[model samples]
Target: MASPITPSTGLGSGLAIGDIVTALVNSDKLAKQTQITTQTKLVTTKLSGIGTLKSALSAFQTLIKPPVGTTSKLQFAGYSATSSDTTKLTVTSDNTAVPGTYSVKINNIATSSSVGTAAFSGGSTSAIPSGALTISQNGNSKSYTIPTGATLASVVKQINADTSTTNISANIITDDKGSRLVLGSTITGAGSEITTTSDITGFTIGKTDKLDATSATSAGYIGSVPASASVTINGLAVTSTSNTLAKTLGGVSLTLLPGSDNSTTTVTVATNTDGLKSSLQSFIDSYNAVVGAVSTVTKATVSDTADATTGSTVTPAALTGDSMPRSILSAIRNELVSTGAGGDLSVLSQLGITTGQSDGKLTLDSTKFQAAMDKGLAGNVQQLFSGTGDGSNGLLARMNAAITPYTQTGGIFDTRTTSLNKQQSDLQDQQAALDLRVTTLTATLTAKYNAMDLIVGQLKASATSITSFFDSLNASKS
Candidate 1:
């Protein structure tokens, strides 16, 4: 069999064969294709709407609910620690910090030891003749041998190179006088004392009480002895190796500012009313958003209707009449208003968060809320939303539990979406099959019409030849 030819246009008998074939195939599949398209469009639209609803619900539940959200850190009250004199000390605290006021007298700030070698004419490049020196701290010692003719910089490097046991840092510091090797303790406090074992006439190398933390570095040996930070808290002595004291008082940390020696500053921690208020407002906003979303999905849509008697249009909500949405919304609304669940501040209304009569959405009265919390309900606010018990026991917890069956993995929405996806895929397959069949039919029609045109042209030529032959014979007889 010959390969079928597809014409450039409707070439068979000039009868627009391609158009006719296309019309036939399209007529055959039109109804079925229309049904599938309509169904897919409706399903997709419904899915989109549900997605919006679910997104809003998930966002609110995850952001505001302590058990289900990152923002659960809101459970811990915020405290602002301020010093009467920030020059003495200004501080920040984590959620663990307990709120209180304490008197702090900084007798002295912590110090680091700064020690150096005696001046040399050549400064940092000056040779540190070959010698073996030992550096000790905290009763542990380590030694390093200087290479012959080592520069002052090279000696500094050798001393600082191995601090695993020496526990001291060395550097070359130079001024107008000359350069010298400076060694400072890696840590602060009396235990961080640095001692050297070496005899060099040009340098004094050893731990000495006379070498304070701020000694001059002009001479061959300038060792600034480290000191522990000392402060008096409530008239009691407190000491720390670091300036920032950790938990010296119950759930409190303090630091001595520079130049606070013999000076006093008071640190006060208190409830951050502004921060708490902002958190509460966030909760209200999330609640409102969820409520609005539910209403959008479930609320009955209204349209105008013609009145039979008065010939006038009357507007009414031709409700979807879907009991599922109504039931879900009604359950949530009832829960919001229901009382006696738990806690003295058991109701959302007590927090000035209440549903509006008209829109069925929630609104927050900031003034009323602030007043309620200020009047001593602040302590119970957490219990009202996030109480201890089963997840459904508290208001916020109830909301979280209610949506879990739909939003969580292997859930209601997941099942519906999966089924819809399969349906869509099946529709696509059917559409592709129809398109292929039409293409095949079109090719068959084109070839058949082309052959028919050739046969018709041949017959017309044969008739013309017969007429010519007959006329020739007639002319001959005449």
Candidate 2:
């Protein structure tokens, strides 16, 4: 902070005036500068610590409360469906599926109906007479105007464009004889069939016609009849328009695969023990992660021996004395240890989750969890974790409620961080004010020192003149 105009050394007084001014300015601002620095460091460190804690809490919240359009992890903890022969069929079940075994026999998988026109001699470039062509399927009919000079490929494109309305698609298949226009329905059922009729010449459209061009009595078109999936579950016959039968069983969906015709398989719905255990373990791990985060932020380290050079042996974390972490842990612990009102598994301990004594983390007893599942307590466990659709009953719900005040917007952590940020901003202002004061003090001290140096120089000049006068008088007397 040395000013360019300030003299490095006084010309008359022979003293370092610039150094003296700078020293005085530094001394005046030292205490306030140190205070601001300390405060700014504290606020920054605390903000970082709070951010870490908030991240941990948010991760835990995401695990408990998933986003919309997603199935909850707890739903998969109850029942699972397995097929004896997956090649023939596969099955999936929800929580509402009953635990039972069923014998399923597949008569045939459903197939869509397809009809092909007789081969034309002009291949894919075959021309057709301009007329209105109507295609009907499942009682839905769509008409297309076949313009003049329309080739087989062009007509196929027009027909396919209206497939959404007709539930039918058209394609051109070329063979050695020529190209044929094939139309197929997008649906599969007993009454779903593709029937094409047009006033165009040489376009014979019928259900029983053959697609071959070499036959003496070749019909204008050939078609394959649509069929539905036929299956028997536990000796009861069931029919579905598609291969996937969802409503056949309550909460159970059966999918028929290829080679399933005349095949039989068994499906067993049972408790998903491994899945439930893994989910519980995940919950335990997430809870422990929060505990670990809190510990990291609040832990204190004390040296075994205090050395004179080191000043102090005790070091505290940013949040060592903060009450927020303690309060958060207390809230979570209260919910974990509380008992539900009405459920077979009222507490988490019943599901093999217990809190640790030394470190407030959760531990899972795998043996006990497996035993609980083996005893058919999966439903009770699910209810315990998820509650009965109420906001306050379930473990997850209660835990969410407990932490909401701290994790929500304008919550405890946010408030603390905002306050700390404001403190940081205030510290910056204080530092700026201190710097300005120092600058002003330096200027004042420099001007006063320069004036004093000038006066001293004048006094020395006067003394030298007086001595010269005395010396001249003494010379005259000699």
Candidate 3:
């Protein structure tokens, strides 16, 4: 491809036309071509570094935000709940819970009503008079027809599977006494009692088989009569139609287990110190991750032994001398150590979260953190990460505010990345144009060298013909 004539082409020109043309063209292209290659790789590396930094910033923001939209668990003053007598009641606490112990006497747990029809002496297939039966619960009712030859089990099955009956469930209990249809309500509130009636004379789901709990065993007793739950929080005698109580304590929920009346229990709600520690630990870990990521991009290093063993030279991060990484570290440090006026717990240091070794990474001192917890997170953990007004004055909020811009669409990272990508595009365009020019110039030079070889071959043939003419003349003279 270099030239039409070559030494291997049997031409007597004695010139390496192909090699000469190629060398000239290559010499003209080497400088600009190398610049394009090196620039492309450098730009790509910078873009990747920016992408990693943005990811770190986004993760730190997620850790700072509320885990759920409903509650600010990250900003909660943690609570621990305990029931002194768990046999009668169980308890749990929520955010904004207060610390207190109160006497709780579960006068009665709410119960759902149930009624059973008169027992049939014959087998479960015993037929009943044709009639209309209506079952009602929780303001919903369903009607069913009792056919002329319907058995006891068929009637029970029909009532149990009716779609219109929302809160009532029916079953046929066939004990030694015989089979009786039992109807119970799904809810325990006062108005949730299940009721039933039938047009057939002397045949209805009535309370004929109600268990007297006071005199019956646990196995024989079933809940009847929809009654409101009764409990005394701090001897205040609160009443509820549901067994689960949430307003009994300032920050706890109490679930009533079935038990006899007149049983007294004690309930306590207090701060969960370990839980508080775990929540704070999240911030420490996330902060450390961001710090490590940024450090790798700004001030990476290697040990002397590793460098010597691997023959690897020291090459700092691309962003090492850039103001962006420096400013990023400085801004986060400012927020981590910043405090509010007259605030109980303002800075991260108050919660025993601190950084060391000239790096922006965070560390939690357990001993100091325990001491802070002893002082109730130096008063309130809520006001620590969330301020007294609007929650914008705390460490978490400030850090979020500082870091949010960097990851947004038009922030510093976006601008810098856009610029780098443009540079990469420009270099690629330059390389393409330069390569086309080199190709064209090489072709032109090869064409010119090929013509020169043809001319030299023609001149050599002319000289050979002249020498033969002289030799023939001398032979004629001899």
Best by TM-score: 2
TM-score of 3: 0.67
- Candidate 3 lDDT over residue span 306-422, tens digit each: 465347666657676778877787888887767742356666777777788777577888888888777865337767676667868766778888987787779999999999989
Off by over 4 Å in 3: 1-14, 66-76, 82-95, 98-188, 192-237, 241-244, 254-268, 300-314
Q: After superposing candidate 1, which stretches have Cα over 4 Å from the reference?
A: 1-12, 42-58, 65-105, 109-229, 232-271, 294-343, 357-360, 382-426, 455-478
State in Å the error of residue 59, model 1.
3.5
Q: Model 2 compared with the native: what TM-score?
A: 0.73
Ranking under lDDT, best-scoring first?
Answer: 2, 3, 1
Number of the top-ranking candidate, with lDDT as the measure:
2
Model 1 Cα lDDT, one tens digit per residue, 80-114: 56789988876665545656888998888887766
In model 1, which range of ten residues has the least summed lDDT?
212-221
Provide the overall lDDT of each model, using Cα atoms, as 2-decimal numbers. 0.68, 0.82, 0.74
* Residue pairs of candidate 3 with colliding backbone atoms: none
